[model samples]
Target: MAADVRLSSLKEWDDDQVLSAMSEGNRLALAELYERYWYVLYRVAFQKTKSSEMAEELVQDLFVQLWQKRASLTVRRVDSYLFGALKYSVIDSIKSRIVHEKFQEYQQFFAPQVDSSTEDQLAYSDLLGTIETELLKLPPKTQEVFRMSRFEGQTIPEISQKLALTDKAVEYHLSKALKLLRTQLRDYSFVWLLISFGQL
Candidate 1:
């Protein structure tokens, strides 16, 4: 009886509970997460993209992809994960439109969470450069997975279908590439800004 009561009480559910529900195709759980973070995500995206329409679009797209990839994703902290994903979405949106100087200003997105040193000019250049450079050093399969997942914005299922591998295998290669980037780019403080939510 108590368990049944708890099951009906979504407001009492933690992130893990919500995610577990999501894994089982629970639309209500997805709605809970969306209601919890969509506004915050939109605000962050708006600050970076400077466009309300763009911000709403990125946040909406993120939720859509989150639903699409829920089974394959290994998210420990939901809010942190959403913020990180939104950062990449904002970058992808602005990547082709902005010059290097304007691009550096995008550091404002991470400035409050990350330190000031990472905002330095050299670090700014290396931040984007390092992502591309380290991306090239991975094994061929890992490289393809990283590009498809990160640069191309494909979900794990999509990559698995395209690459003829299981979703787990695709996730493994994607994780490997990100871990490698995090380790190899540890020197650049800017890299740390993206790799983890908390301290380096």
Candidate 2:
């Protein structure tokens, strides 16, 4: 039970103590670090990305990197260091995504002449089908608002009038739908293509 007492006391330990424990390969110490920083890191990430899944993935990857590099990790203030690391990671992810989007735009410009194979057509159809399926998973009102705004070429004011919603309510639903789809379609290479094509 001595070990239990030690682990229990870890919650009250200072940064240096936690780092020492981590350096010594204590898994409990790593768990403590994760619990201590996950929420704040997630908040920082979410604030920047406005996507819950991206925020979650960033924090999870941060902890995984910390654990993997524990022996070489050096920090005078754990919270400051974690937040700084998170800031850089978020910036890098955003830059990479922007580059990916630009590349997709380039591809779309040339796609009609260069990529008209049956296989390419089938893949594009599959992506649109998947996007529609995910859109259906949204709340009924959100789904309708999103479809009206995106699919029907309706302006926000038009959508509000059509749905009998206040302008604010229509904006809220569109924001929610975009955030949800950003998470759901993150892994699809053609997601940017769809966005550029005005089909997202």
For residues 1-200, write the lDDT of model 1, one tens digit per residue: 75466457867899889888887888878988898899989899999989999799889989988998888999879888999988876775665234333334545653345444645655556566777788788899999977666555455655776889987898688678878877877776554443322111
Q: lDDT tens digits, residues 1-200, model 2?
A: 96798799999998779878988999899899888889988988999999999899989978887887789887888888899888877875675466456555655753445548888777767767777998898999999987766554455544655777887998788788887888877777465445433322
lDDT, candidate 1, equals 0.72
> For residue 53, what is the lDDT in candidate 1?
95
For all predicted structures, in order, the TM-scores are 0.48, 0.56
CA-lDDT, candidates in order: 0.72, 0.76
Question: Which regions of candidate 1 fall more than 4 Å away from where they truly are?
Answer: 1-8, 99-200
TM-score of 2: 0.56
Name the TM-score of candidate 1.
0.48
Worst lDDT window (10 residues) for model 1? 191-200
